[model samples]
Target: MSEPDPGLSSGAVVAEPETLHAPPPRLSSPLARLALDFCASRPAVAGLAVILVVAVAAIFAPLIVPQNPYDLAQLDIMDGTLPPGSPSYAFGTYWLGTDVQGRDMLSAIVYGLRISLLVGSVSVAFALVIGSAVGLVAAFFGGGLDSLLMRIVDIQLSFPAILVALILLAIFGNGVDKVIIALVIVQWAYYARAVRGSALVERRKEYIDAAVCLGLGTRRVLFGHLLPNCLPPLIVIATVQVAHAVALEATLSFLGVGVPITEPSLGLLIANGFEYMMSGRYWISFFPGVALVVVIVAINLVGDRLRDLLNPRLQR
Candidate 1:
């Protein structure tokens, strides 16, 4: 009794070694890892490489372009329709040829890409924020508001995106900002629909219930707990929508209601060359058209990759 039982002694009792689970091997960021994974697929890597090259070229347009295509003063009507690699061109030789205005085809493509990227990026961003907000609110607070919003979304969806843009442009007049606004109006519904669907699921989760029970405000619950979970889908949607938006912008500009003649977008360039396309002056429209296709295809490739990576259901 004075010595104490051996089993009860602290020295006699052996403790189990603490097992530290190695933090689940750090997975690279969704985008970074996905980009790395793209190398596994030739097509994905090709698409990614195309985007990077185009981006770099677009960014360095000022340095690389022989002259600003937009500067009307520098253009020569004689240079117009000069075939690609034509020695007859005023600059001695031209790659991708020139439009009716003799603006460098390569330069125009670069400049047009920049504008397309800008308008597409901005419009999608605007739409994302507004749509996410509307969707979250509708999901968080249903009834009349939900009905009204969802019905509006349905109505908008009934019409084509192009039709919506055309109508809005007609009412507002043509310009980059106007096109962006129209796109946001037309596209917001899709985002809203997506976000609302996500929010509906998230709102029903036990965490949301716990948050509500803890006296968390609607703002905190809606944004803090719910929004982050909803982003992967939204991000993938946004990436694809960028291609859609760029195409739309090009369409608007081609229709003479976008960016204006002075600031030619890819659509406008294509339109400008359309007249000469059959006349053997194909490069004018052909190159820009190819650029647009490439941009859209590349973006879709990346978007598809992102969807596969982020979506558990899609993982093979």
Candidate 2:
């Protein structure tokens, strides 16, 4: 047969063997590769660095702070209204100066950060749990449940979040727990909307279909399968939402409808300092404002980086 095909092809032409090309190396895991890509990017790296520093500061505030802002015994009435460059105060010591209550501005900022971060984190966690549950149920069940849930979300969205928070605060009275409740109530809808959209898409994927075919319970399919896939967006949203929650808490405190007067938030500090600003005690509010800016800015930067890292289209 080979001899016969020398002049003309018997069945098919016998062409020279084509050069074999080595296949591209496979990534160990998509997530691992994505993480590497983010770390390598400048903005992502910088954002991560800033967030790390802030986190470190927050975690070690008790040890790192020069004074305990919360301990009234450590305070001095004469230290109140000290200017920024007072010789006794020192540079980083009174880096921000003292508040009207003679609390070290730097220490106040550190302690304030603890409160703000706590409120923000707890509120975000609460929102995530509630939102994810609502979204999963609404999307998985669909029909009237979806319509009803989404309608409520829409109605809540119609009002400003701060207004809703204010109303809740008024009803609940001022306290840390009340502030958290207000934040959770106002912020959960955002997560619900995001999760619902993602769940709608995920519920129709091949894996979900396969799971359904295998007789997996709806709760398992929704929680075990769909939830994991919906996390990337949720993580980014949660990061940004924490900043918002912190700001909202500050706003509520400033409005005198937030944390107790004994435990002043950054907002309360700002509000209190407003009176002293003309009296030359500028550090009280200024330091807290700066602290707030740093925390929020750092969080936002990290959130933006996370969004880029998680979104395939945004990956470089």
Candidate 3:
């Protein structure tokens, strides 16, 4: 070997990398930072708190609720439409009052909330997975496939999502699964478009070119390299879509096409109470309506914060 020379000197050492190959900051770091920001914002914090409390209540509905609202054996016609704090409530003491079926309003709301959340979350998750995959494939191999997929998205988007959902539900019939399937059909395009847009941008980056040069297979490049980068806006969209889904479910139920009567969602409750509304037995509809509003508003606030944080263009 020739004289090992770095400026003809032997004592030279390279400085440490810009960042050491330290194991990344704990996964919780970003979440903790997000939590801190969330807490600092009053509306966001309040929204998060509401979501947590509602979720907790929904989880513990069977245990905390005095009676199973769905059990006909537990309901008493005599107790029906009792106002809040009525001493003679047949099913027992109820904090929020009783509906026409003598089902505890609070209990029903909790169960309904559970159903609404379950449907919304599961549908969104399903849509996200499928939509992301389609988006990745379309954008990564952008040619006829991209054109076809985007045109389909365009056609889907041109119609009101609710109308399409209504049509799907008509074919699928009424049930929680049907509702979930309908929402997934209506919502997947949004996720696909968002992912495709993000991936289109990501695929052009130099890292992607380098990844391609490394002979990384399409699957690895699509998921291992590209998917992570496309998730920021997708997460924000998910948060907002959850609220939309809940509202949509309620609307469908209100229109008598969503969840079945035996499992009444918030919308069904509102529909049940519509006649009672004129009769002054307002608690049936009023409390559930309030719950729905609170959930939607809270989720929207949180989603707004997420968008502001994730999208630089949306930042002040």
Q: If scored against the real structure, what TM-score would every candidate get?
A: 0.87, 0.87, 0.88
Residue 207 Cα positional deviation in candidate 3, in Å, after optimal superposition: 0.7
**Cα lDDT of model 1 by residue, 2-45, tens digit:** 77667877667665565664455655687667666757777777
Clashing pairs in 2: none
Over the stretch 229-252, how does candidate 2's per-residue lDDT look in tens digits? 999999999999999999999989
Among all candidates shown, the one with the greatest TM-score: 3
How does candidate 1 fare on TM-score? 0.87
Residue 45 alpha-carbon offset, candidate 2, angstroms: 2.6
User: Can you give the lDDT of residue 209 in candidate 3?
Assistant: 98
Off by over 4 Å in 2: 1-27, 87-92
Clash pairs, candidate 1, are none
Indicate the worst ten consecutive residues by lDDT in candidate 3.
86-95
Per-model lDDT: 0.87, 0.84, 0.89
